[model samples]
Target: MNGLTNVSRRSTQLLRRSLHTSAALRDAAPAGQTLRRTGLYDLHKENGATMVGFAGFDMPLKYEGSTPVESHHHVRKEAGLFDVGHMVQSMFRGPTAAQFLEHLTPSSLATGLKPYQSTLSVLLNPTGGIIDDTVITKHTESSFYVVTNAGRRDVDLPWFEQKLKEWNTTELAKKEGGVEMEVMEDWGLVALQGPKAAAHLQSLTSHDLTTIPFGRSAFISVSSSSSSSAADTHLLHVARGGYTGEDGFEISLPPSTTTLLTQLLLSSSPTVQLAGLAARDSLRLEAGMCLYGNDLDETTSPVEAGLSWVIGKERRSEGAGFVGESEILRQLKEGVERRRVGVVSEGAPARQGAKLVDLKTEEEIGTITSGIPSPTLGKNVAMGYINARTHEGLHRKGSEVGVVVRGKMRKGVVTPMPFVKPNYFRG
Candidate 1:
C-alpha cells in the first residue's frame, strides 16, 4: 500500500483529475513536491480516487467510497487488487549471486529456496540491526528476484551496490569469477490479494497456476487486447505470496504492459476490487505482519522482531556467515533483549508509539509498533515488543497485561499473532 510521496494540502484535491509525475520522481522527493504517479495513476483518477501521500508516491487511499465501505467490499465477496509498483524491484544475476546475497542476510537461502520459490529475509548491519526487510525469490541458482520497501529505497539500493562491490572483490568469488549483478528498475509489480485472486488470475493464462505453490513463482505470457502496449504480454514473475493473509499472487510485469495488464485484469477479473493503503494496512495488521517503518527499523534486529524463523536451524549452529552473524548467531542460542508479541486491548486501538506498562510496577516496558481494530477479528489487536522476561511475567499462558490506549490505560492480554487465521496457500 506504499504510494506517492510528498502530497501537499493543495494537491490532495488534484487526485480526482490527472497526474503527470512518474514513480521515479516520487521516490526521489521527500517534501511537498509535485509528486510522481504510477502507471495506474491515471486509472485511479478515472475511478474517482482520493489520492494520498504514502511511502514516496501519490497513491489512491480509497476510490469512489469511504474506507470502511472499501474494506467491507474486499472482506466479503471476491478479492482486491493493489498496485504496488512503488516498491523497489530488482534482479540479481551472477554466478555468485547466491553467495553474495548470503553475505547480506541471515536466511539460509542456499538451502531453503528452490527455483521460483521465495522467502522473507532481513538485511542486517554488522551489529545485527535490521537494515531492511525483503523478499528474496530464487529464479535460478545464479539469479535472484528481490522486492523491498519504497521507504527504504534510498538506503537499500546503495547498500546493495556497496555490498556487491565488496563481495565481488572477495577472494572466494573473485577467484571463481563468472559472478555479476544487475538491478531491474523499470519493472512494474502488482499484487492480487484475497480469496478469489488465484481464480481471477487463472482466467488469463493456460499454465497450470495450481502447480505454482505458495512461496513459489513462474514466468508466463499474458495475452492483451488493449492499445496501450503489445498484444501478448509476459509476466516475468508470479509468486503465490502476499502482504494480506490470503491466497494471492504478486505479479511482476513489464513496464510498458503495466497499464494494459492492469486494465485487462480489472475488467476481466470478477470478485476483485482496486484496494488502496487504508484497507491494506488493516489487512496486514490483522495478518500479524510487520511494516518496515513502524514495526521494523534499522534499530531493531530479527530476533527482537520475532523473525528468528528466517534463520535456518543449521545456520544457527554452523553459521551461514552473513553480516552481523556474530551477534545474530549469539542471540539465536541465547534469547534476545526484547521480544515482539501480540496484544489484545479491551477498548480503543493502541496505536504505534503507545507505551506498554506493567500493571504492577507501572513501568514502561515497550512501545506498540502496529495496532488496529481488526475488521476480521472484530476486536482491538496490536503488536509490539517488551522485555523478554516481562512477556513471560505478564503472560505465562493466560495472564493479562495493561496498555496505554488513548491517554488511558486499558486491559489487554498477551496472545498469539494472526488474530485471524492466515489463509496462505500451501500448495
Candidate 2:
C-alpha cells in the first residue's frame, strides 16, 4: 500500500537530475513505429484536441480552446471525461490470488479489504526499491483487478511474469492453485470527474451511485439510444475514484462502445465537457496528488514522500511479507533525513528544482518539486523537500525564505498540503 510515486513532490529531484535536456522529450523511446492511440483518439481529434506524445501514446494535452477554460468548465458547473486508456489493466484469477498479492505489497489485504473495494499498493523490488505503484480491486476471493502505469508496462510485465513463474514452481504458490494473469492490452478506460459527474452519470444507470463510496467499484450496464452498436449490451465496470480531488468515477468499457459512451455521457449532461491532460495536471496538483514519473521512483520511499499512512498498523507489526520491510520499518521508527512538504510563495511561482534558501544565510535547504499558481486557491502553491529538523529554522509563517523562481530568488512560506480540499465521498 505504500508505493505510489510522489510525482508532484519526490519526482522533482529525480527529474531535475535526469531530464534537464528537453521539455518535449517523451520518456519511453518510440515503440519502434507510430505512437499508440486510445479508443477515443479519433473522437478527441474531431473535438479539436491538441495531441502530444506521452509515454508511448499520442494523447491530448489540451484543446484548441485552452486549458484554464477546460479546467473551469469542469470545476464550476459540470463534468469532464478524461481518456486514461494508456494505463495498464490486468486481472488476476486463482484460488490464492489474495495471498499472492499480499506477498507483493505491504497492505493487510486479507483483513482490510471488502469485496469490490480498491486499495493503493506498491510493487517492491527485491532490494527494497519500488517497482511501481498500483491499484488492486478485489472482485471475489478468486479474482482480483489491477491497474498499473502505462510507462512501466515493459518493465512491469516481465517482472510479473518472472515472479509468477517462480511462484508457480514453489510449494506455497502451488497450494495457491497456480496464478493466471491476463493483460487487457486494448481496453478502453475513461475518467468522468467533477462535482456534477455523479448527476450526469446517474441519468445513464439505474444503480444508486450514492451507495457506491469512493475507492469502490461495480460492474453494471449503461444504456443509451445514441450508442453505436448496442443499446444496453456493454458490461461496464465503474470505480468511484479519481485524481481530480473531486467525487467521480472511472469507467471501463468495450473499445467499440467507447465513442458512443463518451458522446452520450457528454451530451447526456450538457454540463459535462471533454477535459484533457492540461486540466488533469492542474487539478491533481491542487489536490496534492502525484504523477508517477515526476513524483515517485525507485530511489524514493513512502516515509520520505509523506505517504506513511498507507502502511497499515497491523502490517507494521505482523509484517505483510513485502520486499522493503526491514528498511521501511527502520525509517518508520527512526524517520528519514528529508520530508516532502507543501510551500506557498509570495512572488513568481517556483518551478521544479528551484532551490529553497534560508533568508538569513542564503544557504540551500531544499528544492521545489512541483509548483504552480493554483486556479482554486489563487496562490503560488508548491510541493518540495526540506531537511526534517532544519526546515523549521529556514522558513515559517513569519519568516521569509527565497525560492529561485527565475534566475533571482523570491519570497516564500512553508504551507500545508491539498491547496484545495478533497471531496472524497465517504458515504
Candidate 3:
C-alpha cells in the first residue's frame, strides 16, 4: 500500500481500538462548559475546517480538503499558515518586571535575554516540576511579552496573577518598582512556517527581514489590500521563531486586523496554504518539540525532558535562585531516573502510552509519550522516556528495543532527533 493509504488504515485501526488518546481529547472542554472561539473562528469555518474542542476552545483540526500528512509535508517543503490565536498572550510592565519574571522561571531572563529577543522557558513549581512551557520576549528591560499554551491558561494565569500580587506587595518590589500584568484578550496570532517563509513575509513589510534573526522579534507595519473602512496598514508584533523547526515567523496583532493579515499571507505565495491542529501536532513531533500535556506536565522536570539547555550557564553557577532551583540543580548535578529520547520503530507506529520494553528481557522500561508516521522521514517516529541506566547502555542510535503496539512487540531503535534537520534562520 502507498504511504497515505497505510497511514489511513493504521489510523482507523488505532481509533477503533482507542490505542492512543489525542492531546486535544485529553484537554477537551469539560461537559456543560462553553467552548471559546478565537478571532479567526468565522474565517476557519468559511474555509471548511474540521472544528474540534481543544483546550476549552473550538479549534480547527484540519482543513476539509487536506489530509494531516499532506499538510505536514506542505509545511516542510514550502510554507503554511496556522491559526494559533487560542494561545494566551500577556504583557508585563513596570520597573521590576524583569526581576519578577526572573523569580518565576528557570531561564536567565534578567541577565541573558536582550531587548526584542525571545527565549523558551518553563514555569516551575516550588518542587522543580514544570508548570508550563512558555515563550517570553523582552520588549524592554521593564516591559515584556509572554505567550503560553492555551491548555495551560487555567494554571498559568492564576499563577501569574497570584505572583504579581505578591511581588507588587513585597518590600523589594516597593523599594524597586512594582510590576503589573495585562492580558491581551481577543488578540490574534498566526504562524507562517517553512523554508520559503522569510521570502514571502519580506514582501509584506518594509522592515529588513534578514536583520531579525532567529529568537528575535520586531514590530512591523503590515499593508493590507482589503478595502474596508479599517486602516490600510496595521502594526504587528512579529517574532522570528516557531515550533515547526522551520524558518518562520509568528505574527501577533489586534483582532480587527487578523483576517486581512491572514489573507495577505495566504496570497503572498501559492505554497502558503492553511494548516490546522492535526498538521501542527505531527510537525511539532517531527521537530522534537514537546506537547505540554503529552510530553510534559507538572510532574516532569526540564533536565529529564532534555531541556537542560534552557537553563543558563550563569544560573547554574550562581544559583539564579528561581523557583525549583534546588531540585533542578540537584537533578542537573546528579541525574534523572529516566530521560526523554527519540525512537524509530519497524512494523506499526507506536502511539502514546505504548509500552517500551527491553528487547532481550521483554520487560517494560518506559512508555511512548508521542508518536506518528513522519511525512518528512517516511518512518514511524516517537518520543518517550527510558530508564537512565538502560538509556546509557542501550539508548544509542541503532540500539534495538521493542515497542508494544496493541499487545504485539514491534522492533524499534533509539534514534537521535529532530528526525529531520531544523531549518531555523539564525541569521
Candidate 4:
C-alpha cells in the first residue's frame, strides 16, 4: 500500500482502539442527571476533548493543544470536522408530507425546491415570529429531512407534535396518507468543512463529489482507508452545505458507525483536527449564519433577521398559506421596524445583550444578538438588530455607532453582514 494510505490505516487503528474503552464511554455522560450523548461521545473524550453541557448533551467545547481561535483559523485555511449530532434530525414522510410542511414555513418546498436540494428555512409562528431556523432537504416529493437547533428542542418538538396532529387530522389525511414525523434520535451528523473539505472527502467515496453542488445531497457509500474496514462501506446521506458558510458537506449516518466514520474522515492524508462547539460558534458568526437562540427566537421574524430571502419568491406572491403569511407579507411590503445587521467595533468584542447607541447622540437604539473577536479579521465582529424608528437610516452600512461593551462605549460601524466573505462553492 502507498505511504498515504498506510498513514490513514494507522490513524483509523488508533481511533478504534481508543474508542473501545468502557471507562471513557461510561464517564462521557454526566453523573447526576441524564444529558444526551451522541454516538461519538467516547471518541471525543479519547481525543482529549474538553467536554461541556450544551443543549442537553455532553459535547466537546474544544480540544487540548488548540484554542478556539486556533481551531477557527484552521477551518478557514484548511479543513476541520465537527460533531453536530446533538441537533435534532427528523424525517417527514408519507403522502402529502410536502403540503403539510409547507403550512409550517413559507419555503416553497412542494414546488420550487428540487428533489435532493435543501434550503435554510424558518419555522414561523402565527404572528410571524420565528419558531426556529432549520435546514430542510427534499428527498422526494413526499419525504423530507429536517435539522433544527438542539437548543430549541423543547420548543420545536412540541410545535412539531401539535402541527402534525392538526394536519394529519384534516381532510387531507383521508385522501392521501397523513404525514408522519419520525425523529432520527441518536443519529449521527458531522460537518467536514473548509476549502479543502471536498478534496479530502473525495478520496473515500467512488461517487463523484462534484455532482453534489451546494444545497444538494446524495446518498453515497464510504469506507475507511484502513485495509480491515475497506470492504465494509456504509451508506451516508451527504448534503453539500454547512452553517459555517464554507464549502463543505454535512454527512448523516447510522448511530452505530458514527465513530468509525469520524475516524475515517480524520484519517485523510494531511489530517483534519476535531473542532468543538466554541470554534463552531465563532466560525458560524464570521460566516454571518444565525444561531437560533442568539440571533433568532419566537419574538423575531425572518425579515427582521435579514433572512427574508428564505421566503420563496413564488410563495410570497401567491400569499403562501403558511403559518404567518399575513404578518410576514405586511412586513415585506411595509418593512420591519428593526432589522438585523453586522457591526464591527474598535474595542472589546461585544457579547449578546450588549446595547447599541448612536455615537453622535449617545442614545440607545439597538441590541447585540451575537458577537466575537473574529480570528480571521482580528476585529470585534457582531450581529445585532437596530430599530429604524429609533434612529432612522442610521443603521445603514458605514453609519457611525457605539457598541456598549463592559459599560464603555466603543466606536463601531454598521458593517454589512457576512463579516468575512463567504467561500461557498457554487459548482
Best by lDDT: 3
User: In candidate 2, what are the lDDT values of residues 344-380, reduced to their tens digit?
Assistant: 8877677667898887788888888777666667667
**Residue pairs that clash (backbone atoms under 3 angstroms), model 1:** 3-57, 4-56, 4-57, 4-58, 5-56, 5-57, 21-37
Task: Please report, as a residue range, the 10-residue window in candidate 2 with the lowest summed lDDT.
Answer: 15-24
For residues 240-318, could you state the per-residue lDDT of candidate 1 as single tens digits? 9888888888988677878888888887665678887666777777788988877887888999898999876767765
Ranking by lDDT: 3, 4, 1, 2
Which residue pairs in candidate 3 have backbone atoms (N, alpha carbon, C) closer than 3 angstroms, thus clashing? none
Q: Which stretches of candidate 2 lie over 4 Å from their true place?
A: 1-25, 31-33, 69-73, 226-231, 389-400
Q: Would you estimate the TM-scores of all the predictions? A: 0.89, 0.89, 0.94, 0.90
Q: Is candidate 2 or candidate 3 better by TM-score?
A: 3
* 169-245: candidate 3 lDDT, tens digit per residue: 98889998899899999999999999999999988778999999999999997788545434687788999999899
Model 3 alpha-carbon drift over 4 Å, by segment: 1-20, 226-230, 317-319, 390-392
Question: Candidate order by TM-score, highest to lowest?
Answer: 3, 4, 1, 2
**What tens-digit string does per-residue lDDT give for candidate 4 at 321-383?**
899999999999988889899999987767778899988889999998887767678677889
User: After superposition, which runs of candidate 4 have C-alpha atoms over 4 Å from their true positions?
Assistant: 1-33, 225-231, 317-319
Provide the lowest-lDDT 10-residue window in model 3.
Answer: 11-20
Off by over 4 Å in 1: 1-29, 32-34, 66-69, 72-76, 226-230, 233-235, 390-392, 395-397
The positional error of residue 291 in candidate 1, measured at the CA in angstroms, is 0.1
